[model samples]
Target: MIEIRNLKKSFDDNEVLRGVDITIHDGETVAIIGESGCGKSVLLKHIIGLLQPDSGTVKVDGILIADAKEDVLYALRRRIGFLFQSAALFDSMTVYENIVLGLWEAGERDEVKLRQIATEKLGLVGLGARSLLDFKPSSLSGGMKKRVGLARALAMQPQYMFYDEPTTGLDPVTSDQIDYLILSLTESFSTTSLIITHDLFTVKRIAKRVIYLNKGLIFFDGTPKELEQSTDKTVVQFIERFVK
Candidate 1:
């Protein structure tokens, strides 16, 4: 489980997060939604130990990551898979090399085993064809790049998955494909998934629980049905603008 209490963060004169509290149970898929600059990405960074909170506690499975030792933090991080917004693949590397990079970083050195893992994960993400593995990021389309990124993340077989704007630049058809892939993978691995997105369609399709952050605070937290039925003006307006 992930527990965050009284989380706060600031950048020089700007206070981004203000005493935010949230708990994500195991094997659950949660979506965090908010307008740009509402601190959604900042909160995600804090959870993964990329950013230290000014004053708060972030615990992953009872281990306090806020101030853990480097080794401890690294160990915990290995169990978490982060799919960055831009896919973050190395442009110089081939698709197979990119997928196996995660395993190599985790200290795996056997060539056959690494290739096997990469092949399996790529298959899981619908990039099973052996020929595509040799292609670089430049040759793949946006949706294919996203799939390859996801395949890399899955190579870790992480217990927790974090997606940052998983469908930000895709067309509607590709966005729906990504959404379905996320939902299928979560169930396939029984992984705890947390997605940060502005696309309400993705939220409605995959989120079991929706969290709406506004002005650095959790403005609403409930099921998708409750979010639609909410009476708050901010909530209603956000839904009307994004839900289509």
Candidate 2:
């Protein structure tokens, strides 16, 4: 479970998050939506302990992120997987190495075991062939890179999966594929999934709940149907003026 209470953050003179409150239960798939500079990123950072909130608290599965010790925080992070917007794979690493990088860092030395783990995760993301594991990120297409990134995240066997703009750069078909993968993975793993995206289609397709942030606060919190059918002018305008 993820919980936030009165989460407030500010940068210099700007208040990015103002008294935000949210609770995500275990095994839930949720989407957070907002325009640029709406504090969506700040909120996500707080949840994962990337930034300390000026006030309030962020707790992941009962561990208070703001006050956890270094070792505790490190362990907490091990249970959470973040799929960054750019895939963020190291340029110097091969697909196989990238997938097992976390495991190696955590002191896993068995090469055969690492290979087995990588193979299973890659298959989960629809990249079943073992030969592709030898290829570098540079040789893979955009969608393939995203799938590889997803595979790497899954290698941790995380209880929570967070995706940042999972389909921003893909073509329509590829975007749909990513969306389906996300939905399928959520059900297959029963991982608590939280997605930060601007794509309405993604929200409609996968999210069990939608939270809309506006001007440093949550403007709406409900199901995707309620968000789409909202009569509020702010929600309507955001949807109409999306892609900013």
Candidate 3:
């Protein structure tokens, strides 16, 4: 389980998060939604130990990551997968090479085993074509790059997956496909998913629970249905902007 309590952060007097508290149970898919600059990405960084809270506690399975030792944090991070907004792929590397990079970083050295793992993960994301394996990120389309990034994340077989704007630049059709893939993979792997997105369609299709962060605080927390039906002006206004 992930537990966050009284989380707070500031950068040179700009307070981004204020007394935020949230809990995500195991095997649950939760979506975080807010306008840009509401500190959604900052909160995600804190959860993965990329950023330390000024004053608060973040615990993953009872291990306090806020101030854990390097080795401890490293070990804990291996169980988490992150898909950056831009896919963050190495343009110089082939698709297969990129997929196996995670396994190699985790200390796997057997080339044959690495290839097998990459193949399996690529298949999971529907990018298993032999011809595509040799292609580089520079040669793939935006949606294809996203799929490759997801395949690479899955290469680690992480228990937790974090997606930052998973469908930000894709067309509606591709966005829905990515949403379906996320839903299918989470159920198949029984992994906990934390998604940060502005797309209400993706939220409705992928999120079991929705969290609205406004001005650094959780303005609303409930199911997607509740969010749509909410009478709270802030929630209703936010939804109306994208839902119509």
**Backbone clashes in model 2, listed as residue pairs:** none
Local distance difference test, per candidate?
0.91, 0.92, 0.92
Over 4 Å off, model 3: none
Error of 1 at 113 (Å): 2.1
Least accurate 10 contiguous residues by lDDT in model 2: 235-244
Model 1 steric clash pairs: none
Worst 10 residues of 1 by lDDT: 125-134
lDDT string for model 3 (170-200, tens) is 9989998999999999889999999999889
Q: Rank the candidates by lDDT, best first.
A: 3, 2, 1
Candidate 2 Cα outliers beyond 4 Å, as residue runs: 241-244
* TM-score to true structure, per model: 0.96, 0.95, 0.96
Q: Cα deviation in Å at residue 196, candidate 2? A: 0.3
Candidate 1, 1-244: lDDT as tens digits: 9999999999998999998999999999999999999999999999989999999999999999977999999888889988989998999999989998878987899999988888888888877865677898999999889999999888888999999999999998999989999999988889999999988888989999999999999999999889988889999898897655
The residue-by-residue lDDT of candidate 2 on 1-244, one tens digit each, is 9999999999999999999999999999999999978888788889989999999999998999999999999888888888888999887999999999989999999999999999998999889965788898999999999999999999999999999989989999999999999999999899999999989999989999999999888899999989878889999987775423
